[model samples]
Target: MCIRVGEIENMINQMRKSLISIAEETGLNSDDTICYSKKLDELITRYQRLKMNNKQKINQKLKIVTG
Candidate 1:
């Protein structure tokens, strides 16, 4: 039951969209939106790194299986 890289990317995109919508609904100013956007970007970066590490682990297991 492993998640694929594409799925992870999709999840990140969805999260960003949701955050943007939330910010808009809150009627926050541009500066506030920018701050939240920065936080979202940081979160996305961390998720990407985690996904990459998981992918590497899966690849290693695959290599071992095929070897």
Candidate 2:
């Protein structure tokens, strides 16, 4: 599914809050905390990838226009 940057940002914020709450409840090294941590990591990675893809597309368009 195609997701906008704003949506991804919102998800990231929510995930961060959830991770913090989970970590606080169950020690950082606990299973639940670890699971949330990995999920948070995945969200961050997805956000980074999305940004990079957009940047690359912009650069490609610029090159074509400037050519």
Candidate 3:
């Protein structure tokens, strides 16, 4: 479980870094680049929230089983 959480964190970080790099390459001052960055951030946040909710559900199930 710890390893999986760590992996997810790393994946999210990598995705954010990649998006930032792409934005930089495209020139952040441009409206398109800014829009892309904001979209990416929103998507990532949504994904992470979904992941956390799923993890919590699984943990709740595990607790029921173990307790």
TM-score of each: 0.57, 0.95, 0.61
Q: Point out the higher-scoring one by TM-score: 1 or 2.
A: 2
Compared with the true structure, the alpha-carbon lDDT of candidate 1 equals 0.77
Q: Is candidate 2 or candidate 3 better by TM-score?
A: 2
Model 3 stretches with alpha carbons more than 4 Å out: 1-26
lDDT of 3 by residue, 3-62 (tens): 354565676677678777877787768776676677667766766776888889999999
For residues 1-67, could you state the per-residue lDDT of candidate 1 as single tens digits? 5666677677778768877886887656766677777877876787788878988999999999997
Q: Between candidates 2 and 3, name the one with more favorable lDDT.
A: 2
Ranking by lDDT: 2, 1, 3
Report, for all candidates in order, the number of backbone clashes. Answer: 0, 0, 0
| Best model number under lDDT | 2
Any idea what lDDT model 3 has?
0.73
lDDT scores in order: 0.77, 0.93, 0.73
